[model samples]
Target: MNIVLTVLEVTAPVFLLAAVGFIWVKMGFEYRVQFVTRLAMTLSVPCLIFVSLMQTDIAPQALTALSLASIAAYVLVTVLCFVLVLLAKLDRRTYLAPLIMGNTGNLGLPLALFAFGDVGLGYAVVVFAVMAIYSFTFGVWMVSGGGSVIKVVKEPMVGATVLGAIFLWQGWETPRFLTNTLDLIGQIAIPIMLITLGVAVARLHPGRLGRAVWLSVIKAGICAAAAWGVGIWFELDQIALAVLVLQVSTPVAVTSYLLAEKYGADADAVAGLVVISTLLSIITIPVLLIFLM
Candidate 1:
């Protein structure tokens, strides 16, 4: 009973902020998604990652372990999701990336912070960094069949991750004033991201929702199982293990739909996956937190 309340306390705010965005959109409010997303990714999120890594108390060894485990988990998930897409006779370009890349940023980061505090956020950032690098490079290549290494290099989030890792390893810190400033900017990331998620979902016109529902269920299962197995294999600590599982098992990201639309894949089909998976996460995430907590 206590655990249930704890989980609710952690999760309620996330969904509620998202609901705010959804409601705002429904009420015909002006929310510029492209501008907001660009601000978050280019500025706010990078500050968050940098400051989190610089201030984190988690040992470098533990973070390294989590990073490796995250990579292994994604690899396993990719293989399994690939097989699922092939066997289901789905379009690989439309279905594959969404299945492999979950919403590790907007949902996963905040959940980690709420559930496990700073240490959890530290661990979650490592996993997010791993996923982001993979998604920008390999995941993009899977969709566009083109050079994606440059995209990864060009991403501010990637630069921040690398810089943060360097600071963590070197025991470096920015000036206290600068640190506080970055922290202030970073604070807006979670709420803004959550609200943007709701706005994105509310605006998406999902097609083939029946197929989406089943695929989302399967994706949730595969991601959780894969992360669990890899965490155990890598011998991650309790918090790290839990964070990895949660991050890896988040709903399909809205970015997946954007990528599909950009690359001329089945945008509507990917939109279905995004909306259904995100809606399904409301149930799945709370259940997951109950176990993790």
Candidate 2:
């Protein structure tokens, strides 16, 4: 009962608010979505990263464990997807990004924080940092058609991660007032992101949902299996292992849509995957917690 309630409490507001945004967009308030997305991507997200990093005290051992676990999970998922593509005879362009990139930053971070509090949030930060790097570089190369490597170097997330790392390494602390202000700003990110997602869903045509659902199920199932097996092999703690599993089991990231749009990799299909996978995670995540937690 507690777990179910927690899930409802955490997700219901975001989903409902996003649904409202969707209805508004359907009623022709498209401009509002643009404003929300811009706010989320620029001000709220960066502040969230800075504030989260600054507030967390990440020990060297924790950092090392997180890095190793994250990299291992990433590599395992990548290889699993590659094999799936070959065996399933999937279109290389369509499956590449969505299969490998889970919703680590937006959905996973918030969920981890909700489940395990500050320590989980710290672990999530490390995971997000690594995932962001992979998404920008290798992810772009996979989805984009002959784009220059320079595009990856110029990503805002990359810069934000770098700046956050520098602050962490320097052991810099924000003034309490500024920290509070950033916290307030950062708190807006999750809800806004969910609402923007709802708007994005409103924009999605029903015709594209079938293939997306199929791809999402495959991605989620395979990734979950890989995460579980790896967690056992590594002897990870319950909380850490559960976090990794939940992160991996998340839907194909929204970034997959952006990548598909920019690089000509079946954008509609990718968008469908993102939406379907995310919705399905409402089921898959709790199921994971039932055992892992």
Candidate 3:
């Protein structure tokens, strides 16, 4: 019973903030998605990642274990999701990325923060950074038939991850004023991400919802199973293990839909995934949290 309440407490703000964005769009408000996304990803999210990694108290050995573990986890997930897509006889380009890449940015960050506090957020960011690197590089190449190294290197988030990792490894710190400035910028990342999630969902036009429903269920199950097995195999600590499971099992990200749309690969199908997977998370996340907490 207490676990249930704790799960609700941890999970509610994530959904509620997104609900606000959803409602805002429904009430005919104008939200500039591209602008907001650019702001968050370029400025706020980078600062958040850099500062979080630089300041995290997690031991270097543990952090190193997690970094490697996260890479292995995603690689395994990609194989599992790829096989699932093939068996389902779906279009590989459209289905594979969504299946493998979850909403670690928008939903995963806040959930980690709320469920396990700052330390969880630190671990969550590591996983998120690993996923982001894979998503921007390999995920894009899979979807677009070609991805550029130059383009991937130019991404602010990618730069931040590399810089932050360096700082963390070297025990370096920015000047006090600079660190505080970055911290303030980083704080806005969570709320903006959550709200953007809701807005994206509200505005999505989903198709093939019947297929989406079943596929979403399958995704949740496969992701949870895979992440759990991987975390155990890695022998991560309690918080790190929980964060791994939680981040890996998040719903399909809205970015998947945008990528599909941009690449001309059945945007509606991806939108169905974003909608269905996210709705499914409302149930799956709370249940997962109940167990994790």
Candidate 4:
């Protein structure tokens, strides 16, 4: 009961407020939600990355662990995508991105901060940075059927990661004023992401719920299992391993749908997968915490 309450306390407010915002959209305030999401993606999120990386202490060992974990995650997801395609007899384009790109940014980051605090958040940032690069580069390649790799390299998020990496590598100490400014912007990221998720959910089709549910279960289960087994074998620290497993268990990222829509890869299916995985995460995440924490 205490665990349940804790989980609800941490998770519910964000989603509930978003739900209210969704209802407001039903009453004709949709633009507000869009504006917030755009602000977060374009401004707040980059600041969050800059602030977090600039402040966190990055030892060589920690960097090594994070690098290994990131590679593990990428390899696991790639193999899973292949198996899923073969086993489910899915077309290459249908489930590729949605299957590989879990929701590591919006949902995973917040949950890592909540569960493991600063250390978890730092580790998540490392993982997220690597995953972001892979998703933008290799993911686009796969989805675009070997289209211009140069175009993928030029994505704004790719540039953001590169900029953040330079800051991290230099071990730049952000001035107090700058850190404070970035922190203020960073604080808006979580709420904006949640509200965006809620608004997206509000547009979901009830008729597609069954398929969404199945995809969510598969995504959460397989991802968690892969993370757990690999993490244990790799001897990752408790908190790092926990963060990795929880991140992997998250639903398909919202970006999956965007990419699918852009690349013509079953956008509806990707959207449904995102919604389903996110909703089901309310259950899977807590259970995962029980094991990981």
lDDT of 2 by residue, 27-50 (tens): 987446667777876688778877
List model 4 lDDT by residue over 174-210, tens digit each. Answer: 7888789878988888777766777766775433567
Model 1 error, position 287 (Å): 0.9
Candidate 3 lDDT by residue in tens digits, 185-221: 9999999999999999999999999999999999999
Winner of 1 and 2 under TM-score: 1
TM per candidate comes to 0.99, 0.87, 0.98, 0.88
Q: Number of backbone collisions per candidate, in order?
A: 0, 0, 0, 0
Tens digits of lDDT, candidate 1, 102-168: 9999999999999999999999999999999998888888888874788889998889988998999
Score each candidate by Cα lDDT: 0.94, 0.75, 0.92, 0.74
Residue 159 in candidate 4, Cα distance off native in Å = 5.0
Clashing pairs in 3: none
Cα error of candidate 4 at position 222, Å = 1.0
Q: lDDT: which candidate is best?
A: 1
Candidate closer to the true structure by TM-score (higher is better), 3 or 4: 3
Deviation in Å, model 2, residue 292 alpha carbon: 3.7
Listed per candidate, the RMSD to the true structure in angstroms reads: 0.8, 2.5, 0.9, 2.5
TM-score between candidate 1 and the true structure: 0.99
In model 1, where do residues sit more than 4 Å from their true spots? none
lDDT, residue 251, candidate 4 = 79
